[model samples]
Structure formats: structure tokens, C-alpha cells
Target: MGAEVITVSTDTQFVHLAWHRDEKMLEKVRYPMGADPTGDVSMLFGVYDENTGLDLRGTFIINPQGTILNSEVNFYNMGRNIDELMRKFKANLHLSKHENEGCPAKWKEEGDKTLKPSPDLVGRVYEALQ
Candidate 1:
């Protein structure tokens, strides 16, 4: 779980402060909240909506080597699932350590059995899963 999380918004710094202070929406947030009123970051991430002057929900997981491991974009109304994100993160970490293995659906932890890609696995995934 050695990861850094930062959130970027099109709102100004004052707006972010107000939301954190008055609205108390982000009062408990411990990570940095970057204000990108100019939409530079949003544009870079391709989440900015030019017409609406807003950003869609975008989540990116970048590895330590500056490589993007996962990228997901959703409509403004759609919320993200942190648990699923954590699962994917763990799987990525596991794969980085075990390059010969593959994580299957519902693989959650370090000790979870991973799939070994092979011709024998073809047409027998259900049996392999069991």
C-alpha cells in the first residue's frame, strides 16, 4: 500500500478551501488537493469537457517508474470504487513481482493463487479456477 494519491479539480484554490472548510466535504482528506482552474491538468489527462468547462471523473494509477498502470474515466455522476482500485493495485504489485503469473477475477491478496498462462489453460479455465 505504498502509494501516493492526489486529486485535481478545475476549481480555484479558494473554492477548494471553501469546500474543505464550509461544506466539510473534504475535511478528512489527508492527501494533496490540487486546484486547476486553468484546466491544464485536466486537459493533460483528457478529462476536460470543453463545452461544459468541467472535468469527467478520471482515475489514473501510475507506478513508481512513471508508467500508467490503470486509467479509468467515468461520467461526472459516476463514483469510483476504492475497494476495486485497491484490488487492482494489489494485483499489479503482485504481477510486478511474479511476472510469470496472472491474476484472475476475485484475486484479492498476496497469497491468492495466480494463473499460469499455458495452452493447457485453454478451454479449462473453470477447472483451473476451481
Candidate 2:
């Protein structure tokens, strides 16, 4: 929750400002909106479509140490799920604190059971999950 959230677009700074000023659009968005008119950042993230000259939906979760924990890119028409992003962020935070355990599918909270990597877990993953 302490992490900084930034949205980068291929639009110019003026366009970003206009959008922020639009009450019907982004009036309540207090986070920084980066304007990448040249698509430099989008290109760097491989979200820029060369043919369309538009950036696909790209979301990156970077840690405080500048390490990217998660990267997801989707088509322009597809929208992102903030709830899933928050879930992954929490899971990453948990993994950072507990290096020995692995968060399994559908793991939601800190108290959720984690998997310990071992030879026994290889063939009995369904059993261990139970």
C-alpha cells in the first residue's frame, strides 16, 4: 500500500493534464500520470505496437529496490483487474518476507498455507494442498 502508482501513456503532457482536468474522466486520480509521447517508456517495456503506434495495456510491479516483481501486458481492448494486481502485490510482499515458502494458487492472506519445496511435494501437490 505504500508503493507508488504511476500510469504512463503515449499521449503528451498537455493531453494528460487535460484528462486530469476533465471531471468526467480522471478528476479523482491523484497519482502521477506520465506522458510518454515518444513511446520511449512503452518501447522499453515492449508494450508499444509498431504498426499501430499505440501502447498495449502494460502493468508492472516494481519493488522498492527497483526490481520488477511482476509484468503483465494485454491487448488494448483488455482492461486490467486492480484486485488481482493487489493480490499479487500482497503475495509478492509475503514472498519477500518468507523466502522459504511458496505461495500456492488462490493464496489470499498471510495466514494462508504455503508450500515448502521438497521432493515429497513433487508428486503429492494435490494431497499437500488439502
Candidate 3:
């Protein structure tokens, strides 16, 4: 929960301001809407499209040490799932403390079952989930 969120795009600050002012979806967003018209930030993240002059939808969760814990990239028209994003963020946080466990795709919360990766866990994930 101690993470900062900044949504970056190729749009200018004025464009972000107008969208926040006029769009119902962005009206409640209080985080910084970063303007990357030159695509520097997007290029750094490997989401910039040189042909279209736009960035694909990308989400990244970075730890305090500046390591990227998770990255998800999608096409521009594809909307992202906040629930899944939250799940991945929570799993990353949990994994930071419980270094021996791996969160499966279905892992949703702290109390959810996690797996200990070993040779024995290779072919028995289905049984372990049960």
C-alpha cells in the first residue's frame, strides 16, 4: 500500500488536464498524469510505438529499490483490469516478506495458499491447489 502511482502517456499536460476535467472516468484520479510527449518515459519502459507516436498500455510495479517487480503491457485498445493489477501488487508485497513461496495465478490475497517451488512441486501444482 505504500506505492506511488503515476500514469504516463504521450499526451501533453494540457491534454491530461482536459481529460480529467471532462472525462467522468478520470475525474476521481488524483495521481500525477505524466506528460511524455517526446515518448522518453515510454521508450524507457519499452512501450513506445515509433510508427504511431503513442505508447501502448503498460503497467509496472516497482519496488523501493528501483527494481521492477511486475510488468504488464497491452495494446492501446485493450483496457486493463484493476482487480488483477491489485492482485499482482498484493502478491508482490506478500512475496517480499515470504521469500519461500510462489503465488499462483489464482492467488488473490494474503491468506491465499502459496506454493514452495521445488522438484516435487513441478508436476503436482493441481494437487497442491486442492
Candidate 4:
């Protein structure tokens, strides 16, 4: 899980990017992420809160071709769901490998049957929820 971590700050004139050779901060992260001073990337993603001048603490799953597959920017009283994010990533990757279907809400791998997007199916799901 040697994923790269980066932060966007509006303090310096340029972006900041650094790494931690030591793995003291978190597990599975041998290197710590760096930050960009200007926060260009954050601005582009609309995660840069102008009032606070800080990123909204979001995560993005980008594909190999540099396409953003999923993104969410939320800070106050909200945080990204690790399990859902991982599930989405895995589902997308699986779709790339095989001709599978999408994931429904609270969907776990081989967990439950997914409903298709249709009027009848929607009514059934609504009834089930009720």
C-alpha cells in the first residue's frame, strides 16, 4: 500500500512535495506524502476552501491513464468511507478484467444481489427499505 500522499497548502508560492523514508507515521506507508504550496491541484478539484485556504480532505482514485475514476471532497462532520472506496476501486478493477456488473448500495464482494436500474426494480428496492 505504498500509495503516494500529497497535500495542498496556500502558504508558499510554489507547490510542496516531500516523502518520508521512515515508516513511523502510519502502517503500510513507508513514505509520507508531500504538499503543494500553491494548491493548484486542490483548486482544480474544487477542494480548496477559500475561507480556510486548505483542502477539504478528499480522496481520488485515478486510473492509469490519468482519469479520475472517483472523487469526494468533504471536511466538516464528514469523512470518506474507506470500505466503500475500496469496494468501488475493486469493482472498477474487476470490470476492467471481466464482464461483471456494478455494485449496489452497501455492496460487498459476493455479498448480496444487486438490483438493476428499472422501474420495477426500483419499486422493489423501495419496498424492501420500507
* lDDT (tens digit, per residue) of candidate 2 on 1-130: 6788999999888988887787675666789989888899999999999888889999999999999899999999999998889888889999999988888888887898889989879988778878
Clashing pairs in 4: 15-37, 16-35, 16-36, 16-37, 18-34
User: Between the candidate structures 2 and 3, which one is better when assessed by lDDT?
Assistant: 3
Give every collision pair in model 2.
none
Best by lDDT: 3
**lDDT per prediction?**
0.89, 0.88, 0.96, 0.61
Judge candidate 2 at residue 18 and give its lDDT: 81
lDDT of 4 by residue, 32-106 (tens): 344655678778887887787777777787777778877877775686677887787766565455544445666
Q: Report the alpha-carbon TM-score of model 4 versus the true structure.
A: 0.63
lDDT of 1 by residue, 1-130 (tens): 7889999989888887778788666667888889988899999999999988889999998999999888999999999998999999899999999999989988998998789999999998778888
- Candidate 3 shows a clash count of 0
Alpha-carbon shift of residue 37 in model 4 (angstroms): 1.2
Name the TM-score of candidate 2. 0.89
Per-residue lDDT of 26 in model 1: 69
In candidate 2, stretches whose alpha carbon ends up further than 4 angstroms from where it belongs are: 23-25
- lDDT: which is higher, 2 or 4? 2
Better of 1 and 3 by TM-score: 3
